[model samples]
Target: FSYCAKDLGLVLLAEIDEAEIFKPIAQLKNQIIVISIIISSIFVGIAFYVSRTISRPITKLRNAVDRISKGDYNYKVDIKSSDEIGHLGHQFDEMRKSVLETNRNLNMLVKERTKELTDMTNALDATAIVMVTNRDGRITKINQKFIEISKFTEKELIGKNPCIVKSGYHRTEFFEKMWKTISHGEIFEGEIKNKAKDGTYYWVKTTIVPFLDENRQPKQYIAIQNDITDLKNIEYALQEALKRDKESAEIIKRHVEELKRTNIELRRKDKLKDEFLSMTSHELKTPLTPIIGWCGALKTPRILGDLAPQQRAAVETIESNAVKLEKMISDMLDAQKLDLNEMKFTIGEVQVDLLFNKIKKDFEPLLKEKDIQFIIRAETADIRLESDEARILQVISALLYNSIDFVPKTGGRIEVTAESRDNNIIFCIKDNGPGIPKDKQEFLFKKFYQVDTSLTRKHGGTGLGLAISKGIVTRLGGTIWVETEEGKGSNFYFSLPRKY
Candidate 1:
């Protein structure tokens, strides 16, 4: 180191230190090391900044993708950045929602389909005799109903041809037609007769439907059956009943013809009987008329010679009985006329008071003989009826005689009254006599009905007086009725139309 300055040697030959010569180089080296350390620290801070902004978000996205791959749609991809990663996270959440909804819909659709199939199967089992067969007509499946109705066990029926239950009633052509229809994939419906294991026959309304393959040919058949055994029997019974009814109708027609002939004969006989009665009554009345007249003449002193008391009494008795007989014949003729509707009425204005007076006068002698009290009460003073005057007198006389015969011999009271009633004139004959019983009162107006049937009874009547009176009053447009109680007296009333 001293020899470098040897040309100027004499002055620099003295001691130079090594440390002082290398001091600046050592300072430069220290400055270079400090700059390297500062650069390294800056690079480390940049790496940390990149990790906070990008690496953490990418890691979160990776974890989200992992969760989504495991079907964890509930986990939220909550990247809140306004960058592509945030958009990606939003799209992934939407996809997860869509997948969840699709899964739910799929589950619902599966349940619905399963339920429909189950219901269809159960309905087939419950209601019908179901049978499934292959194209070869061998039974593959049969419902419980088929087994129960056929009286065949499942073991015996399965894999067997449907001919096992065939009844001989159906011909071979019947089954051939059914199979031909089904083979062409058509449905065949008919009533089938089948024999059971118990040797009994049953009928079924059967429908055979073919399940077609892609080529439109039958691969299998499903035969649905409904038992119609009872219906067939009912149809047969109805046919038999109709046949019997036809026979009965012919018999009834013959009976009706016979009845018509009998009815005609009866009409002819009734007319003949009426004619005979009329002739007989007229012939009998002719003889009685003269007898009644002669008896009256004998009783009169002026017409015939005066007789002794005994002779007079006998004549009077004959006259009275002859009068009774005449009255009976007249009643019979009147009844016959009424029955034939041939009675004639001479219509005229009849004063009710005169009619009553005539009734009182005709019955006066009998009333006096019985010592009965007779009263004539005319509530209608000038009431006049347009009717046959002679017939009115006859009815009044009959009712008066009926009352007089029944009244007490000593203290009998008879009341004859003519009163104005609603739109009519009412004539009532009341008697204080033994009242008719409740049960016999209704029959008092019938022909030949006698209230007093005892043999020892004091009253004597032909039982036709009231009946004839009723007929005459009815002919004159009137109604007759009697009111009587067991202990009370009797009142007989007849009403005639006031205008008539």
Candidate 2:
């Protein structure tokens, strides 16, 4: 190795252990690698510990949130780190419980609402006459009430046109108006007359509701109805009754007018008959006055000439008949004047005693010839009356003559009496005679009215003496009446107002 100074390098190379010399450096390099590896191991261990502390809990929270977000509320955020993450997990769990409670309440509310809707539908089906129609106006559903009224089965009515129940009462324009309203998604309410399956007619109050689509146009229709046929029938009956009443009223008005016209005609005829009777009686009385005067003059012997016995007897008979005829004519004229209200009266005071004496003297001879006793009675002497004296005497004379004709020829009795009573002087002519029948007494004062036709002819009276006497008494403000019973004595009474 130290070989010769071949060079200093050769001698230095003979002293060099290159392996031993590089040993410390190699040791140092190894030492540095080991330290570097140890420090890296420590850092990795710390990193792993930090990730377990922070990232593991964060990952668990994220997974729990993910499950909760997926609607898996049963999953729990179970971070038990005693850090902020555990508190956050507790709050999240509370919020989940609140959300679950809210959901459950909402479900219960939905169930309750659904049940209420079902009950309402059932009630509507039972009570209402309900019908539903599709957009094509075909029947889709109907209730029992609808089936009963329409008299149709469910199978027959389903999918049938609503016009199947038409009564032909509504015109086309009516349905047109209804369709127009519903087509615009409106509600139509109205009364409809419809016919049943059995041809019976009915009325209904209907409401149509249109269901609209998203575009706001009607997609379908539903109808509900109730019966009103009875009301309509009653209205028709009332209209007919009112018409009949109006006709009856018109007929009654016509009959009343006819009756009024007939009554006016009868009044006119009665006035004409009264005028004719008055005119005829006056004409007959004028001619009778002269004949009665001539008969009286012919009976007097001195006025004409001395006559034989038979001639005198003939003249007397003629005078008597003429006097009776003249008296009858005078009575007829007086009766006619009373009917016309044309009789004249002279008012004065009449003395009762003096009037009675005159009547007694006038009828004395006739009373003797008939064998009748004529008696005059004065109940109150000095009796006075406010009346026509001549009319009073005429009334008394007619009654006396009537009695004289009817009295029994052999044993007849007559009395003429005058009396004063309250506010009147009453003159009564009573006689025992064959009295007038009660049924005929009322007609005795009427002109030409006699009790018996046979008795009037036998007595030779015109049957007018009583009529004239009543008319004269009435004109002097007095009343005349007779009280008689068949086969009994009769009393003729007349009263005039007493004037003080």
Clashes by residue pair, model 2: none
Per-model lDDT: 0.87, 0.83
Judged by whole-model lDDT over C-alpha atoms, candidate 1 comes out at 0.87
Residues 1-500, candidate 1: write the lDDT tens digits: 44455575564345757787788888888999999899989989999977866677778878988997897767777777667767777787788788878978998999999999999989988998999999999999999999999999999998999989988998889889988888988899999999998989999999999999898889999999999999999998999988979988888899999999989999998889888878988998899888878888887889877989999889888888988888888888888888888889999888887777777778888788888888887996798878888987888888888888788778999998888888888888999888999999889999888887889878777788899889999989999999998768899999988766
TM-score for model 2? 0.46
Maximum-TM-score candidate: 1
Query: What is the Å distance of residue 465 in model 2 from its true position?
Result: 3.0
Q: Which ten residues in a row have the lowest lDDT in candidate 1?
A: 3-12
Q: Point to the candidate with the largest lDDT.
A: 1
Q: Alpha-carbon error at 257 in model 1, in Å?
A: 5.4
Model 1 TM-score, 2 decimals? 0.51
TM-score, per-candidate, Cα-based: 0.51, 0.46
